[model samples]
Target: MFIESFLILLALNFLSAGGVNRPEERIVGGGPIEIEQAPWQVSFQIRGHHICGGSIYNADTIITAAHCFFLSGAWQDPRHYEIRAGSKSIKSNGILVKVAAVKVHEYYVHKENQFFVLQNDIAVVRLSERLQFTNKVQPIPLAESNPEPGTMSFATGWGNMYGADAGDANKIPIHLQGVKLRIQSPNFCVRFHGQSKICAGDSKHTICTHDSGGPLVINRQLVGVTSGRGPNCDRPATFSSVPYHREWILNAVKSFPQHV
Candidate 1:
């Protein structure tokens, strides 16, 4: 829950983008990243196509943005999605795990007044089987405590870079990319994302289309989940505050019966 002292607004344009900026590409003003740089990073896919990015929360669970399914009008049935981990390429080699269940925040609902705002944009995905942990496949710890404003962090993903053809599957990046970003003040985020969300980077350096559901990490801890981006992938991007939903995540994972 957000502190009572804070209040907010919706940068309607950002939410109305309608999942166009998924796999929001490479960190703007950043360069190509190594395949194993962020081992916990995973690609959320439909069939064999990459739709969004997510973080490996544990051996059999993934944490990603809820809007990844809702905003894109994707089927929520576990059979319709897959997790490709331990690799950067969308089509080549990796451990492809079938999804068993997708637990979206119960309170996460889309509002339809003027802005189609999807609040509480987080979800937990349970894999059908436990994943093999390796140098290239591992889980990242969620941030136990929130970091201060202006803290440096990195966001890595295989989304579109430079907004080229943005949502075009053919134009999305195959190799992952990473860029350095700085956490923004709550006030800065309120201008674009509203409460319970945070902003990272600035006009010159920000996450873009196709990168939603990716992790924003600081000190190797998962701090944020990529939520939405400004139009054209430029300007500051909003993310679901990981620390804010930590308790819900723990309970969600604990309630799921382990699968063999």
Candidate 2:
């Protein structure tokens, strides 16, 4: 009986932490959105499974959180990843393209103790082939300036619909989802995530686990990349500020010019 109980507990832990159907890929308090509405969104998958969210930077490039490529304290190979674009569903629909290269920010860091810590959590992904642009497959422009606190922003992803404490953390949605979040002041964001992150969200709406590497847009401009969140889904979420790293992003894209 004791052994059986122990086995059950172990299985539950694994399901909660690593199960693909688990709540890790959620946009809490969000609703289904059409692919044409957020055409720049993409799914950063590993071995055909949606692991993180990203945004289409151009026909052959994607921008996502660097931590998406980090697993078990190590960086995964770029070859193991692919980008699914022009779709609203993770299970079906979209153009799957091979990943040619992944470039993480030079200052990015990943540390683990009781909890994981990520810094400078941004990355750029080069695609193996150029994407054919359509109304449902377009690029979003990077924000030239950060939005002031109280500005409204939008976040999209295919993560969990409920918080971890809600006893339904495994409720993974089938279609893409989005929510409106209010940008918090730099002082408020820095207090929790430091200066390198942009803070946004509220008690009613926020990003969740699989939402990492997703885009946070204001006025249709990419202002942030989803990075982290508080203990609950209702709390504010943090992102890598696009404006703060705009130069690096531009240079990175330039260094990897598209082939004719």
Candidate 3:
């Protein structure tokens, strides 16, 4: 009885220490992701502080979770965000691009439930200038079709391994991280929001704080965008389904101004 009580207390402490469904979460049981392993991975920041991970979809366009811009309040100004590409380390060298515009999904909504529920949690960021692709930088193609449930996928981010506190310096990792996770059934995550979200991984291969806005790729194609995740990072990580909103993304990218 005493041991069970201690365990319950420990769980409660963890929840209190790391808030649930943080804005930007990371891989909990993943290893270091090398600089060139995922060239399309980009660090989304505000004033040089890494807040979330994003993907380079084209020479001038990025895709991330809408919650990154819409959570806590209404959408924020694009000028307040910066995109850093070609860097494995958030603090290392990379091409910093000023945001030209922000395009969030029209139906996105945040709910204040026991779960940090997000619906249609997807967005795009247009760069002020075209990024020069190098050995360390490139664009990833979006999945034309959704990966079937149970398919294995890969996710990358710069979030913490220990928990969600950016102030906890010791838990923060400098190098980017990646984890292999299996895609869970849309029905499995339906309770959180609906079929628009994909739940992947479990408690071990979970997304923790600072990894939000990252991409879930299968066979080099982005199939999902990291959105809300559980307090423990181990709860099946929820992501915005990319395939479901592919049309919107393409239209948004096409409508945005392109720099020559």
State in Å the error of residue 68, model 2. 0.4
Off by over 4 Å in 1: 1-26, 71-75, 112-116, 164-171, 190-195
Candidate RMSDs in order? 8.2, 5.9, 8.1
Candidates ranked by TM-score: 3, 2, 1
Q: Which ten residues in a row have the lowest lDDT in candidate 2?
A: 14-23
In candidate 3, which residue pairs get closer than 3 Å at backbone N, Cα or C atoms, i.e. clash?
24-209, 24-210, 25-208, 25-209, 25-210, 25-211, 25-212, 26-208, 202-234, 203-234
Predicted candidate 3 versus true structure: per-residue lDDT over 1-260, tens digit per residue:
57435433332233233445644477888899786889999987766666678999988999998877653544556776788899888887988988889898989877765645578889988988899999889899988777787899999998779876655656667889999989887666435545577788877887777788899999989989998776666577888888888999999899886676
Local distance difference test, each candidate: 0.73, 0.77, 0.78
Which has the higher TM-score value, candidate number 2 or candidate number 3?
A: 3
Q: What is the lDDT for 228 in model 2?
A: 71
Task: Between candidates 1 and 3, name the one with more favorable lDDT.
Answer: 3
Single out the weakest 10-residue window by summed lDDT for candidate 1: 3-12
Better of 2 and 3 by lDDT: 3
